[model samples]
Structure formats: structure tokens, C-alpha cells
Target: MTRGFADRIPVHIQQVVEAMVEVFVNQSENIGNEVDYLQVFELSVDTADFFSMQAIAHSREEPPYSTTTEFVTDTAITEKVYIISDDYGLEGEVITYLLASEY
Candidate 1:
């Protein structure tokens, strides 16, 4: 079953996650008041581990962003996926895409 977006990351770690997202956004290229691209970070709750899942920036008009997931042994252990919508918005808009852990 899919988990709720808010439930993916524990309350204690949300701040850390958000801070990391902000750092990524600040470092990314700014294209005409909007971000040039988006980034998805796959995170593991058990190991406190995470990795980037590169995403292509879709039009702001698009409802859902487009992304590609390259399966690796470690990804199967991931418990949550954070989707950062590369746009003009501030860091407060980051969303977490929750995944059911297989391990």
C-alpha cells in the first residue's frame, strides 16, 4: 500500500530533509526565474541513506512531473522518494513520494 506523503519521513527528520532539499535548490541553475531542472532524491529510512534520482523538468503546466527510476539493489531498499519540483517556488514546496519498502 502507498503511504501518505507526510508519513514518509518521520517528524524528527523532516527538518534535515528539507534543509538538504534547500541546498540542492540553491545550487541548481536558475533559468529565467525558474529552475532549469528537477531532482528526485531516493531515501532509505532504515539506513538514513539517500541518493539522487535525476528528473527532467516538465512544463509548470504539467500536473505530474516526469521521472525515470534506474533500479539498483540499493533502490529496492529505499523507503521514500523526495520530488523537488524545479520551479520558481521556494524550498517550502518540496514533496515526498512515498514508496513501500521491500526490505
Candidate 2:
């Protein structure tokens, strides 16, 4: 049987985790000014359920606003996949962009 890499050190893990966060950010930006859109992103690597995350949006009303989203090391994924985001909901700056799309 083929075995997966099971050891996660701080240095290597940091790099890998950062890469995953980048994926999330990219997916978020892919939404752009479009509405009624769904962007899906498969993780960079198959992570164990024990992963963690942290997310931050740099700006709300600008093109170059940066958003950093993190994931925890432990999450359950069964049946329907959970789409968790720090700013997915709530009336934030991004909301304006999405709302404007409604005409």
C-alpha cells in the first residue's frame, strides 16, 4: 500500500500551509465583480483533518485589496463539504461590490 507523508514540521508545514492560503485568496479574487458565482478550489495538498486556518481581507473597496484566509488543522468533511470563510457573510466592503451587481 502507498503511504502518505505523515510528518508536519513547522518550517515545511508553514510553507505548505501558506501555499494553501494563497489558493484560497486566489479563488476569492476570481469572483471579481461578477455575481451569482461560485468558485471552487481544491486544496493544494491533501491535508489531514487536523488543519487550521486564519483569514484576513486587506481592503473592501479596491482592486488590490489583499485577503488572507487560514484553515485549522482539524475539520470534518463528510456528506456536503463545508464552505467556511471569515468574510463570506456579514455586510462588509465586498458586499458592496456584490450588491452593485444586482440591477
Q: Number of clashing residue pairs in every model? A: 0, 14
| Candidate 2 C-alpha error for residue 16, in Å | 0.9
- Model 1 CA deviation exceeding 4 Å by range: 1-3, 29-37, 45-78, 84-103
Predicted structure with the largest lDDT when compared to the true one: 1
Candidate 2's residue-wise lDDT over 31-52, tens digit each? Answer: 8642222222223323446454
Where does candidate 1 clash, by residue pair?
Answer: none
Q: What value of lDDT does candidate 2 attain over all alpha carbons?
A: 0.32
User: Can you write out model 1's per-residue Cα lDDT over 1-103, one digit (the tens) per residue?
Assistant: 1255455555434444455555544544342233423334454423224643322221222222333333223223244443444333655543434432421
Clash total of candidate 1: 0
For all predicted structures, in order, the TM-scores are 0.40, 0.25
RMSD of each: 9.5, 14.4
